[model samples]
Target: MSNSYFQSDLLSEFDRLHQQVASLFGGFPYSVRSDRYGAFPQLNVGSTDDTVEIVAFVPGVQADQLNVSIDKGVLTISGERAPAFGKDEGDESRRYRQERFTGAFRRIIELPAAADPDKVSARYVNGCLTISVGKAEASKPRAITVQ
Candidate 1:
């Protein structure tokens, strides 16, 4: 049976507000990923039996600016979250407590042994990037029927 109290409107409202604050502040922990030189958008890495999944949250970034590829079991996502409001013309120099991320960034993660980079697919929607790497045919589990 479903718990009626779990569907309270107040809880839903609170969850909405919590998400709003997190997005406005560039997600959680506010840490940028970098291999050596340059940072990349925040990402979460995981996998399933059929495919490996990766979700990257990169706001204010253009799809063209992003680069996604899987080579040698390593998945890489590189892109630049251009400064909002179009900071063009190089008007001298001014600085404040700018927590917002700018410039280019990249995040790389190693996939599981069963992941097949050749069969990977990616999609970008509403500033969120999702990549799925299909599992190798040999690695898939086969169902056995009892006689």
Candidate 2:
């Protein structure tokens, strides 16, 4: 019984050391980062006095290929980014490293309390997709009237 207890304690210590080493080396499957929320098309979400704004960093994607929709206070952005290199028969293109994402991606962002789904607009500018959702009139702060 005493030997079993000692073995259990040793196993627990080993497990703690293993976790520490994993964290130091950025966890397992080094391709994924611990800080990122999801795969493809990182986003920035913010809110103003009367509107909520969302910006997605999507390069090499066209406006027509992108889809933006809001349903039940959730905003979804979907799109596909194609590879820059075209197939060449005579000329061979060698690639060493590619960190860019070239595939279909979907990101869903939750709207703030003041955001109104009906009053939403989206546009693609440069390499970014910007979405703006207006707040309801009642949700916006109002100055009280003094008699």
Candidate 3:
């Protein structure tokens, strides 16, 4: 009979609808959605006064196997990792547990508006890929002139 009661009922109804939709779709979660959040090659992005710094945690992948590129203000990181178990393994060899991820993976990162595509550099060292994109001169912060 109170306003708070009505709000609570409405919120519960929305929650029930969400559960029903998730069940209908076989209980898919938002975090696993590739379009929403990239699932491979975890990335850390930051920005300084003049440059945007990006670090991708990608182990077991060599520099030759990885590729980094920027196009239309989007940075793409792609690569492949070979399977730990090789075909040479005999039938006696059994894989009781396999947790490592293998095969090809690609992740697209939308760069900020200030990122300059032409002034970008990348390097892979110690299993980490670091990329730095210079910001546009107009986008960099400047001290205002005081009258």
Top candidate, metric TM-score = 3
Record all residue pairs in model 3 with backbone atoms less than 3 Å apart, i.e. clashing: none
- TM-score of each candidate structure, all chains considered together: 0.66, 0.69, 0.71
lDDT of 2 by residue, 18-100 (tens): 77765575422222113233346877777788888888889899999899988877778898988777353344678788777
In Å, residue 47's CA in model 3 sits off its true spot by 1.0
Candidate 3 lDDT, 1-147, residue by residue in tens: 568866667777887887676556542322212233325677777889999998888889989999998888888889997776756344457777877778898777777888899999999999899999999999999999999
Write model 1 residue lDDT over 59-93, tens digit each, in one string.
88888999997777777788777665444655545
Q: What does the lDDT come to for candidate 1?
A: 0.72
Q: RMSDs, each prediction?
A: 10.0, 9.6, 8.2
Better of 2 and 3 by lDDT: 3
Backbone clash total for model 2 is: 0
